[model samples]
Target: MQPANLLLLTIVCVLVAYGVGYARSRSLAMPLGGIRHLKSLPFYYGARAALWCGLPALFVLGLWVAFQGKVIQTLVIGSLPQEMIPGNEGEASLLLSKISNVASGALPPSFVEAPIVDASERLQALREQSRFYMSALVVSVAVLAGFLGWVRIRPKVNARVQVESILKWVFFACAALAILTTLGIIFSVAFETVRFFDKIPITEFIFGSQWSPQTAMRADQVASQGAFGMIPLFTGTLLISAIAMFVAVPVGLLSAIYLSEYANKKVRGVVKPLLEMLAGIPTVVYGFFAALTVAPFISDLAASIGIEASSQSALAAGGVMGIMIIPFVSSLSDDVINAVPQTLRDGSLALGATQSETMKKVIFPAALPGIMGGILLAVSRAIGETMIVVMAAGLAANLTANPLETVTTVTVQIVTLLTGDQEFDSAKTLAAFALGAMLFLSTLLLNVVALKIVRKYREQYD
Candidate 1:
């Protein structure tokens, strides 16, 4: 049986075990007059049975699925004649692909040698045998384990204790998986970044002025060993993000304040959803709007004012990005502001403080940490945004603070570097990982700063 089919069968077995355990528990309680006679409830007994029936079988299936392909490939490669064996990883991969195609009837038998045809047949036979054995073993283990659980169920058995114990470990495993995954990403990026630094000096990448990264593939080809400097990209990113935050923070905060404090229920209901609808619109749509409408208008206005502006400028992109991320700030700030104790506002009012004065001093100070968090989230959103920047800001990599000039961000360059068909071994590809590492560190620093602010304000308010 196939893995998917086996999985379905195992689920059916678990459901059956649950039903049997539940019924038996209730039956056992009949002579004693009620289910209260049992050590634990029927639900816990059912759950324990289900866990016993599912866990071991699933563990076996997962291991088999993970290792079967590699085991089969190793066996096939071992069986191949010395002359037919591949010399390197790339050649081995190519050979495997061809063999897979032939085995699946994607390639004709006549297209390859008799030896390949024999190998393909062996591969098909081994796969079929492996599936049959895996299905039988999984099903057998599930049935045996379930029978034992059902047999062990008694009026004195503590099924709830066993079930809860298993569940606590399951939750711990999930948390560990999340931590491990994050560590895996950091290490992978760090390794590639180390490789990138080996190819280009750390000082040059960090401080050099130029931004070009194009490297020649061949010695005879024309290319500038290309600058790996990141100063320009980081500058553009900050410039665009600053413009966005300038546009977003005050507007979003004021809107949140009005909605939470002054607006009636009806107005809040209608306005809040409409405001959140901005977040639902695709970034691509925002990019088109920025490029076609905003960028052109900004250019024309700049020209009218006798100031120079690029057809695609950072101001246009940042403004549109700010508009896009307003929902993040407004929604979060509204919640934070609303979360402030109503008694505090009432106390300020009773003391003869005006509404505006109370809001500015009491309410705002209390919610400042949460509001800061929202702003930090919006700033991160602005920094990471790519579509609007690419469409409106243009990928010029200009080391300028002017919002009216063209610029490119680290994210845009990372996308550009990794977009096309590229080899992972090249410095160009490794540069993307380096960029990712820097971006991660930049966000980490921002989080540290935001945490400091939150703690400082929280201390003051407390």
Candidate 2:
């Protein structure tokens, strides 16, 4: 069984044991000579038993699974014929893999050898035996624990409280798992970035303006030195995000206003979902629409107006990105607007202010915090968006503000850096992580600020 499956099985076994214990205890404590329980429910006792049996066993199972592969490989290699072992670790691993495949009935003739074959067979048998023993042990422990828990149960036992406590722990574990996963990703990126910094100075990477990432093909081959200035990328991301915000904020806010204040049920029912549909459209589709439809149209329009325009102008990409963020901004703003207490609106109307006057003077100001929060979120999304920029925005990292010129964003640069042939240890690859780190920090900061503003505004409303 896969380790994940085994782990799941172990958990199920524990829960079953707990149920069994709980049921048995309740049955024994029955008032009459019938099956009715006198004390806690049967399931509670069983669950308790299951928890005791399953947790320890599963913990051991996880630890063993983590270390088993390396330990087993080492043991197998030590047992192999000395002559059959390859000189390099990589080659030896390949040989070991071939031997394993052969034992599993997938061995190729080129790697087939009598000693290796024998070793593979022995390893397979050992693994199978170990699995069988472990399974038996798990089952035995679960049953034993369940039986013991059953013996301990009484009419006075507070099964509900115990169950609640167990559930809380379970929830805590799930939350920890999620947090650990995020931490793991961060650390993985950070370590790789550190490795990259070792090859290239931080100063050069951060401040360099020219971003050509080509490396020398051979020791003697002439190659253009790669430039890693991130200004252009940052500029592109900001520019596109600005354009998107410009498109989204006003439209989204107005939509929110119409829906919350003016629109009747019939209009709202039709419009809200339609606006949400914008969010469901795949970004790649938006990318192509920008490239094929919007880009050309805008370029032609600009030319007719006596302005120079690139086929893949930032304006086009930014405009499309703005369209993408509109739903996000509107949906969030709508909720915020709706959340504003009706008392305030009623009070404004009672005071002789017109609907528009109340919305402009009282409601909009009150909902401004949430509206800004939504806008900040949209900015983050626009900054991080990759596929649209990759397709619609040109690869040129021009650090210019002219919307007519093409530009690239950080996400696009990261994609290009890691794509095609790449040496993982090189400056180019590492730059991707640094850029990612910066992006992550920036978004995180924005979210924090936005959340803080929302919280303060919420307090005011309350």
Candidate 3:
């Protein structure tokens, strides 16, 4: 059976187990006079039966799905003739791809070697056998476990305790999985970054002014020597992010203040949704808007004022990005401001403070932590944005602070470097990981700064 079909079947079994368990518990309870005589309720018994019927079967299914491909590939590779075996990981991967294509009927049978055809047949047979065994075992285990759970249900058995214990471990496993995934990403990026640093000097990467990532494939080739300087990329990223923040912070904050403190229910209802609609617009649409409208207007306006501006300037990208992130800051700030204790507002009013004065002293301070958090999130969003920048700001890694000059960000360069089919062993490809590591560190620093800001100003309410 297909995994999806098996999953559906397992769910049906679990539901049937729940019904059976519930009925059996009630039957036992009636013999004992009433459900009050049982140690726990019928709901607990049903839930326990369902958990038994589902959890073990699901665990086995997950393990099988996770490891089946690797096991099959290992077996297939081992079965290959000694001369037919690949010498390297890359070649092995290619051979496996071909085998998979042939097995799936994508490749013509007449075009391949006889050994490959045989291997493809073996792969298909093994897969069918594996699926057959998996389905039978999973179904048998589910039925047996369900029966055992139902039989074990007694007046003295504590089903609630067992179910809660299992759920607690499941939650812990989920949390651990997330942590492990993050660690895996960090380690993978770090390894590639180290490789990148080995190819290019650390000093050159960090302090060099130019940003060219093109490396010559051969020593005789007259291609760019590929300056791995990150300064230009960092400069462009910060310049655009600063422009975005300049446009976003004050406007978003003020709008939030108005909405929370002065705007009536009707006004807030109409204005807030309209403002948030900016967020719903796709970044690609914003990219088109930036490229088609904003960039040209800025260039024309700059030319009219006799101030030179690039047709694709950081101002266009940053301004549109600012508009994109405004709802993020406004919505989060509005929520935090409204969440401030009503008792504190009333106390300030009783002290003859004006509404504005109350907001300045009491509510804003209370909400400042969450506001800072929102702003940090917006800044991160601005930094990570690529589509708008790619369309509006040209991807020349120019080391200038001028928003009117065309420039590119670290993220843009990372995307450019990894855009095509390229070997990972190249410094050019590894540079993407190096850039990613830097971006990750920049975000981490922002989080640290936000925490410090919150700690310095956080208010406590009893």
Best by lDDT: 3
Q: What does candidate 1's lDDT look like per residue over 283-389, in tens digits? A: 99999999999999999999999999999999999999889888889998998898888889999999999999999999998999978976886787788999999
| lDDT, model 1 | 0.90
Which regions of candidate 3 are displaced past 4 Å? 1-5, 75-86, 90-133, 217-225
Query: Per-residue lDDT of 377-418 in model 2, one digit per residue for the tens?
Result: 788888889988888888989989999899999899899888
> Of the candidates numbered 1 and 2, which has the greater TM-score value?
1
| Candidate 1 weakest ten by summed lDDT | 453-462
Name the regions of candidate 2 deviating beyond 4 angstroms: 3-22, 32-43, 49-156, 178-183, 216-224, 303-306, 420-422, 456-459
Instruction: Enumerate clash totals for all models, in the order shown.
Output: 0, 11, 0
Clashing pairs in 3: none
- Compared with the true structure, what per-residue lDDT tens digits does model 3 show for residues 243-321? 9988999889999999999999999999999999998999999999999999999999999999999999999999999
Order by lDDT, highest first: 3, 1, 2
Give all TM-scores, in the order shown.
0.85, 0.78, 0.88
Q: How far is candidate 2 from the true structure (C-alpha RMSD, Å)?
A: 4.9
**lDDT value, residue 118 of candidate 3:** 87
lDDT of 3 at 125: 90
Sorted by TM-score, highest first, which candidate order results?
3, 1, 2
- How far does residue 192 in candidate 2 sit from its true spot (Å)? 3.2
